[model samples]
Target: MTAAVESEAPAEVLPGLYDIDAELYHSDPIPGGSLSSSGARKLATECPAKFKYWSEHPQPVKKEFELGTAAHTLILGDGPELVVVDAEKWTTNAVKAEVAAIRAEGKTPLKPSDLKRVTEMVAALRADPDAAPFLEPGSGVAEQSAFWEDHGIWRRARFDWLRHDGQLVDYKTTKSANPSDLPKVIHDWGYHQQQEYYLDAGLALDLVDPEKPFQFVLQEKEPPYLVVVTTCDPVARGIGRHLNDRALNTFALCRASGEWPGYLEAPLTALPAWVERQYA
Candidate 1:
């Protein structure tokens, strides 16, 4: 007899609130290749408003690295109980070493320079009266600033961790000015679609307790900059809900209309050509 495999239930997510459907239909991203704010600024002195937003907000990008670390530890594993994806063997070994060190002492698993950057950022934030609440160890809201819920999408999101009480977070890294000021950073990065998507997916999955408030972890840095923590207010959460709902609805519309390929193709088409040009 064949053994039966139990499939996991799909995670729930919140709806998007922005005009994403319209936006997607009206405007499509250049499609492929990673571009940083500096690239955008270099592309144009004025740059697109979108790129400008990114330059003003660097935390989201740093959060990507933090998520990568979490994915390495929590999701990808080996020795018969795990599957490795997206990362190479060397990267896996490095993660294993780092995880081991975390178990050995109070020292951070991330690099010393990274830790120093984070500590300095925290100090800077604490220095600012407005940023203090979010940086304080016991700041109830700060501790549980952000939470994640699983979405049964193609790739799992890294924002799965929550405080014991279910606070979601998206940690950031930057080498910027005093880390004390958080509100401004939060405002710049918090409005992006990806942030809303994370929040929405979590909300839908019911991964986060509705009773707890939601927030993001903003890390800002310049070349010589370090980490600083920032948070969003109710308005930010509301914006997340709106944007996520729109993305979801757009996805649904694409699926039903059988026009999904266009969206997928948009990136596929541009990326290969850009890569080929690099070689040529």
Candidate 2:
């Protein structure tokens, strides 16, 4: 709905160019939404048909997404003013009506059980030694949007939390916060690309201190609700940088040539890496 918002960047704290709230920014149409790192990664990983479907469709907000949103609000956001559910519990003749009411109000639709889990996550995070810095007053910036033209293409980032000291934190609510499980988790979600992309976006926007760290504040949804703050190392960041380069180049070529490819034209079977071990 709004064009690229250009403003004088903030001094040493974070870039302040696009000061709009999360709701309005997320509602932006077409190219404004198209060029986010998540979208780029999605396009890069998916078949052209899947990517095109997403480009044309409105995503169904799933229960997990609602829980994640609610958890973010409880832990790192403006909190429950934006969260609307019928009540702590309800048996009603009007399920659709209540949901429509929540949607109409421009709020996050969360269930009572969702809030309970979010509260649990907050407690877990608070108890974690790694969370002390983020818990400090004025330590972090929340939900700030920044947009700019990269080369000839427009791109954007909505930071979860950017510390004044220059560290960036992305809050994630997942089923597993176990250290051993994180690589696959991160790979599946393209979090390496996200961290690399977000950090670069922050640097380009002057929204963060480049020499500082980029981290994820990961908390599991299921008990015992483990939480940790961790960063991808140089190798992961390098891989991410390469992936982003290819994705961006692919996007630019697709834009110019108007070709959206799907599966490889050649026939091939896709197999898991572990399949080779089984052959052994």
Candidate 3:
């Protein structure tokens, strides 16, 4: 009997430097993906000023240092094998606990519009049969981070799971029912931005040189919604450069002016808009 030759296509990939719309970062989908909506809202309200305070001052050694280090240690540990298990375990349990304590009492939890947005994601994933492949098989989470510099601005992003080749990846649970519809949805949401920002940060860190490439792993939540991967071309990071400046500037002004009360008193919606107007 003759053995049939098996041919396989190369995996999809992405470049290492770029920018992403903030929405993608906020739209993660897992059991409690939308769970944080209430907490984020409370922060916007009860301790409105705290946002500025938190943004301006460097994070305390306990949080920024201890947790981050712990996360890395867990990532490098052997038992979990996949780094994301460590990350999800850390994020869902530890991060949630810390936020709960620091959050004020008597400040009723507020519902952000993102709840509806994420629910929409869950529904779509359930409708699509192909999305199953994209769902994290309750495994395969890896830890990664990137550092970057642009026009004197500096930034860093730490994440979980990347392709074996060091290609940047952001996992997702989608809302599409049809398998074929996934690509269009991913493109429309500026899904490319997630990997781009990481790549840009990685470039700044000098982790990879020119021709640096990466990938974005899309894990769907629906049946038939198996994994979808995409590779992209490197592009100039114009908006990312600006946003980094804005975040840094917002932090600096809060510190230098000593006028932090306005942030706390203002409407929740106003903070982002004001930050943009000031930095833009």
Candidate 4:
């Protein structure tokens, strides 16, 4: 996989799409600085100070993500290689050492059981009548990175699967993919914001139509692996756009003033509405 070139100047990254490695994209190759959808969420929902710290300090890989990451690699035909550890448990020193070696080679390490689960998940996704069309081979590209300038600020997005017909698909593996639970999942995970942010990138790059909606292909990470194809409604999209604007403005201000402030020293406190109702 080819990595994106980084330079001291942000201008070096011309406004366009590039097929780059995931690691390079996550590393933020735009020299001066670039804001990603995840970073935008942090800036808008959390505090700027927290976002800054996260950007500076990349977190170590978590074991919980191994299954999902492996699923993506198998389903999308992109991302890191999935190396099976062939061990039932990771309790032994040899197994631990082997897992570390796999990671050192920039590949994901998974147990035999996890590998089987990931394979089954991919099979289920491909067999889905609705989800199959979006990810049909040669119909789209996966893990394509998009970089563009928004109001003089560098912004970037990595699309999971972008179809030639201007359809954007984001895949997510979750514990529960039931339709009834998606609204809360969308809000809790900031999927609305992510949808709009990715749409902005596609629009800026002329890869997506204004009328086309951003879609999510969510699947359960268990037997049967139920799949659902959904999109943000107009109202949710509006909220997403509003939040993205707030994040952009905050990011620009922080970049200009070099001040990433946290919350107020003494913020007003409020009890939960449910908690207060309990007293009634």
Best lDDT among the predictions, by candidate number: 4
lDDT of each: 0.37, 0.71, 0.38, 0.87
Instruction: Please provide, for model 1 over 49-90, each residue's C-alpha lDDT reduced to its tens digit, 9 standing for 90 to 100.
Output: 443344335432232354233322222120011122322332
Over the stretch 153-258, how does candidate 2's per-residue lDDT look in tens digits? 6666777877777667888988888899999888888999998888878777676777778888888888878887788878988988888877777777777777
User: How does residue 172 of candidate 4 score in lDDT?
Assistant: 94
Flag regions of model 1 displaced more than 4 Å: 1-156, 175-196, 222-229, 260-280
Question: CA shift at 254, candidate 3, in angstroms?
Answer: 2.6
The candidates, ranked best first by TM-score, are: 4, 2, 3, 1
Model 3 Cα lDDT, one tens digit per residue, 1-280? 1111112211222212222321232232112111121222223243437654443353323432222233222322211111112122335676565444543221111123322333444444344454323333333334433333344333445444433333344544445524477556644554444445555555554543345355444544434434555554334234333433444555345445655454334444455677889888
Worst 10 residues of 1 by lDDT: 74-83
* lDDT comparison, 1 vs 4, better candidate: 4
Q: Residues 1-280, candidate 4, lDDT per residue (tens digit)?
A: 1223232224466887888787888899897889999998888898889989999998867889888899888888998998888898999999999999998888999988998899999999999999988888787788888889988999999999888788898999888889999999898899999999999998887888667677899999989999999998889889989999999999999999999999768667879999999998
Question: Candidate 2, TM-score vs. the true structure?
Answer: 0.82
Per-candidate count of clashing residue pairs (backbone under 3 Å): 29, 0, 36, 0
* lDDT ranking of the models: 4, 2, 3, 1
Model 4 ranges with Cα > 4 A deviation:
1-11, 278-280
Question: Where is model 2 more than 4 Å wrong at Cα?
Answer: 1-16, 27-34, 79-93, 135-137, 268-280
